[model samples]
Target: MQKLLEIKELTVSYDHEVVLNDVNLTVHKGDFLGVIGPNGGGKTSLIKAILGLVKPSKGQILFHIPQTRIGYLPQINQIDKRFPITVLDVVRSGKTDRRSFSLFAKQTEEIAHAESLLNEMGVWQLRHKAIGELSGGQMQRVFLCRSLMNRPELLILDEPDTFVDNQFESELYEKLKELNQRMAIVLVSHDVGTISYYVKTIACVARELHYHPSNIISTTQLASYNCPLQIITHGDVPHTVLGLHDKHQHDHKHDHEHDH
Candidate 1:
């Protein structure tokens, strides 16, 4: 497969503290990579680095295609509801190549593409409505449509499942699977069990990164990678899978408990 993005010895820091340490990763064409880790485990940091939101303290991020070709769907909570932007405008804004205000002034093919994506996402009817008026699921769908407006070669989503119902989540994952047929995807989620079903590969990020070539990962492997997370399974009867703790870790925990 052709390489889309490459991260070489990437390091990101905040206020003199290292968030990501020597992380190396490669995203290839048609790759669906699921990023999983505990909260504050540098998963978001890595995404920020890739998106150029936070400059890396060291290393390089090389994109085979122009940065404008990368699409992003941020966590819904990060969006300010007070923003007065309409759904149609939001989606049209995703065309980074277009100059400001051209979204409305230009009746180009990009506008049609944006509308097509909204229709596909079942939000075409709500295009005129303000994004704040939409439900969480609707907002997510709108944002997804916006991300697709750019016709990106690589799509990056941060916690796309947050604040959405189970049905929408399932639908979103299925849609993403379909999108992967055309472009590479980097999905950041805390749910390992769920993404394991859709993603082609996995990366465990906790200050450092461990790339697992297969989506199917074991609790032992997660522990070895130092990525301790609670895995939730979805079915009629949902269950949880905890990370396996080794004797050394268990003993250390026990000793610390006894000390306190």
Candidate 2:
């Protein structure tokens, strides 16, 4: 249960607008942390801050990677499928930092490793296919394989289940759980009903931060969030801590702003 990553009073902003505020959390080895929130709730921003893709406006993200490596899989929606790349090429891209491809003898081992990861993700058959041709699930699996190619000690994923069907979502979580045996995983997901079955802990984010150790959060804690929310536990669907009418009203107001 060694701490793998720690965020202390972390804050992030975009274009001078504050997104994350005073966020604090810690991740441990073998931990599966599910980050859940409504859209535009700064979930992606927090992940970006953790990956060093976005600089925190305040505070720090400390990594205990003295003997470990970090790998990241960004949200599927954020990826540019228009790139003229093949599935194999995308997976191989994960090894760009290694020996140059011109030295075939030196890169042979890395190529084989990438192929094995692709096969493990069940996408090796589409290795030569264009990335744009694959379904959303297939594309996600391809990137997931690429992330695993490094044999990471910590894996961070942003919205790993977006655009995927239920079956593939289940498969993805199962594979992630298997991977968690060797590496800690931190995932940003909105699918509250399914995340608890696979993840060991939950971190609910909004404009602020709330930490829940158990997948089953209490009604009091949910009330403290003062927003439409629920908790999942032991394969059960999320049950609302707030009334349905209130949630619907809140959703309407939330949507109205987006329409503008």
Candidate 3:
């Protein structure tokens, strides 16, 4: 339960347009945090701030671990696949950010580690393939491998479930659960139902951040937090949250049942 990262009064703005305001959060060792919100709700902005990609206009983000120990998997669609890189090379690049290890031993160890990650992701056979030639799902798996190549203490994934099949989604979550035993994970996802089953805590971001200490959140709770998102339900898990209502304000309820 040691603290890994902490954010204090964080605010982000672009050209006078504010995206995030006064957000505070803390991550601990072996934590699995799920981030959910509507589009343009500052979810990505918050992530960028944490990764130091975007300078916060106010407040600060503190990391107990070295920045090099943090791994990031960006949204797959953001990657330009035409870069003419092999899947294996892509994963190997993950270690370029750090150079403390012995040169000779590092290359050999990193290559071996990269291969293991690829194998675990079921893409070792496609190691030599050009990234552009792979399908969306394959690309996702490869990036996932790349992110873990550094053996990071904290792994951050932004909408990792996008553009993948149901099977891969299920498999990915299972794999994440396994990975969570070793590292803290911050996952930004729209699929609340799936993440709720895996993430230990939840944070709803919408121009502001609402840190829900438990994965199980009530609709009233979401409303009170000012986070409005459509709850997509499926499966046997049962809980009652509120349904998304328009300006018309019709009374409707959403069941937080999830597929196992």
Q: What is the C-alpha lDDT profile of model 3 across 1-260, one tens digit per residue?
A: 69999999999999979999999999999899999988899998998898899999999999999888899999988999899999999999888565656888878888899999999989999999999999988999899988887788999999998998877887888999999989999999987767776787889999999987767665667778888877775553233223332322222112234222
- TM-score of every model versus the real structure: 0.88, 0.84, 0.90
Model 2 Cα lDDT, one tens digit per residue, 1-260: 79988999998988889888999999898888888887888898998887778999899988888422677898898889899999988987776445344677647877788789988999889999999999999999999988876678889899988898877888999899899989999888876667755676678888787876655444465567642464443333344322232334343321212210
Sorted by TM-score (best first), the order is 3, 1, 2
Clashing pairs in 2: none
lDDT of 1 by residue, 44-140 (tens): 8898888899999999999999888899999888999889999999998887866445555665777788899999998899999999899999999
Candidate 3 lDDT score relative to the true structure: 0.84
Quick one: RMSD of model 1?
Answer: 8.1
Which scores better on TM-score, 2 or 3? 3
Clashes of 2: 0
Could you tell me which residue pairs clash in candidate 1? none
Instruction: Give lDDT per model, in order.
Output: 0.85, 0.77, 0.84
Off by over 4 Å in 1: 99-106, 236-260
Cand. 2 Cα-lDDT = 0.77
**Least well predicted 10-residue stretch by lDDT in candidate 3:** 247-256
Q: What is residue 149's positional error in candidate 3, in angstroms?
A: 1.5
